[model samples]
Target chain A: MTDRKKTTIVLLSGDYDKVMAAYIIANGAAAYDHEVTIFHTFWGLNALRKDENIQVEKGFLEKMFAKMMPRGVDKMGISKMNFAGIGPKLIKSVMKKHNALPLPQLIEMAQEQDVKLIACTMTMDLLGLQKEELLDNIEYAGVAAYLAEAEDGNVNLFI
Target chain B: MTDRKKTTIVLLSGDYDKVMAAYIIANGAAAYDHEVTIFHTFWGLNALRKDENIQVEKGFLEKMFAKMMPRGVDKMGISKMNFAGIGPKLIKSVMKKHNALPLPQLIEMAQEQDVKLIACTMTMDLLGLQKEELLDNIEYAGVAAYLAEAEDGNVNLFI
Candidate 1:
């Protein structure tokens, strides 16, 4: 418990709060006094953008979804099945409201908390993005890079 | 913006922290003053057990993995991948640490939050479970049942 070691999380999804979930978990891990690292890959890279402002849906169905559904990104953290057209937005707003850490903060906190923030090299290549496109705080590595970390122990999470 | 309705979320993952992520998201939804429902099925059913404890690694390597990886169920929420032995135990410890939300509480939360909690009847029949075996709060239905809730434009998440 008190002697807990560091934990690494590999986040694959790009949705706002799904990525934010990594932040929450990383922050929580740091809170529990574990060293935490987050690796962002594929769609997950969206949140790492320096000035990322992906638009919230404003159409009718999306609007209707917003009404009948939750209000922010914190509620929409699922990677597989998606429901409301507006789910991701709601999840985000809630995360913001809750002061749940953002990717930028998570990265910074990981630094302050000794958590690692890595961006998947393969995902970056596939997306035609350079490492510079990511937030200034990220460390770039390959799948092998993550595997090297996961190989360390039982606590690895593919978030 | 003000005209937007509350978003609804279906917390559907059965994996370790994925389930917890669902709860965190649901809790976030609740914070947003919206509705949230977590439909438990298959492996996710394990997280809802009244007597079962969440999994943690006892092996030296596992302990090491546990420390270096995500620490709890709330931290392990990710889509399925072939990561050798790291999957299940990571799921367990987290479920245990989160105090495990009961199927009933998930259901009640849905009711209170104006979210619908539906246990996949197909998964139940396939898994040899009955609605009665589930916490009393859960309602049983097939894909038709889930679709009934999903058909509306509310938020749906398959964790």
Candidate 2:
């Protein structure tokens, strides 16, 4: 059998820094030719939000969730020092100065690198997020799917 | 060579849930006979604080850090839904109901299980955290020490 490694990350936190770390690791591992899969769930779904609103019908709670949550990676708040949303902007400028890609660009890069992006269907249902709300070209799956991929994986992380 | 594995966790976030997560993973990995080392730094040092004040001489910034930061894990505020510090208390009560160990207890259990606890010396210098401010029977090290342990670690987590 060929010697290959698989890296699976369960991106559970929606925080800006954590999501950035997840993508960075995923892309870095993929660059090493490791088979990579990122399972985004719960708050992590916010990372996949489209910038423009999609006119999808939802219940009151779901509507509230969608409206209250940040629209996309560019709008995400820092977990700390988020003084009325200014911290994220400051970090964005710092990222720019360091020539680090923004979260959107990082996500795009991970996708381009053939890193599998799977959204937890259960989380989407619970959060009232429709497929139209997320970015295109991503697959939807459940925990069983993730477990199958991670069972013999050399590296598994829960972010 | 033995089949034993090493797991190194970098505790960077001082948020209540996040710190709890770090310990939970450490304890769980220890249960599976994996060697675990937790590197605590920056705000993460808040988790290592003793609830009672320790009469130790320190510089002005050190004293200020000791006074301003949370005294211990029990005093840490949640990263989100803090709601004026109610969220952590709520979670603590839930943990009690579920017969789950509190963060302090988890720390103790980790120590008892021989999990290595390393406080980041550079962060201590930066944050003005003196050795006396932390728990006893722990190691003090820098990133090089962590790297030495993590170089061959099958699991390396940055929390």
lDDT (tens digit, per residue) of candidate 2 on B58-109: 8988778778889899889876557788667756765564466788999999
Categorize the docking of model 1. Answer: incorrect
What lDDT tens digits, residue by residue, belong to model 1 across residues B1-159?
233233333343545545656666766676676544555544455344333233532433223222333322333344565265365555555656998664335535645665544565533433334343444455665443333333232344546
Q: Model 2: DockQ against the native?
A: 0.09
How much RMSD separates candidate 2 from the native structure?
A: 6.1
In candidate 1, what are the lDDT values of residues A1-159, reduced to their tens digit? 234555577777755534654565566566665656778776666556555423443566534433443222333344432345333443334345445444556556656776777877776665555554456756888888777765553245564
Candidate with best DockQ? 2
Candidate 2, TM-score of its B chain: 0.95
Per-model TM against the reference = 0.42, 0.65
Q: Model 2, A7-115: lDDT tens per residue? A: 9997868889989999999999999999999988767888998989889998665665566667788878877898988998899999999999999999999999999
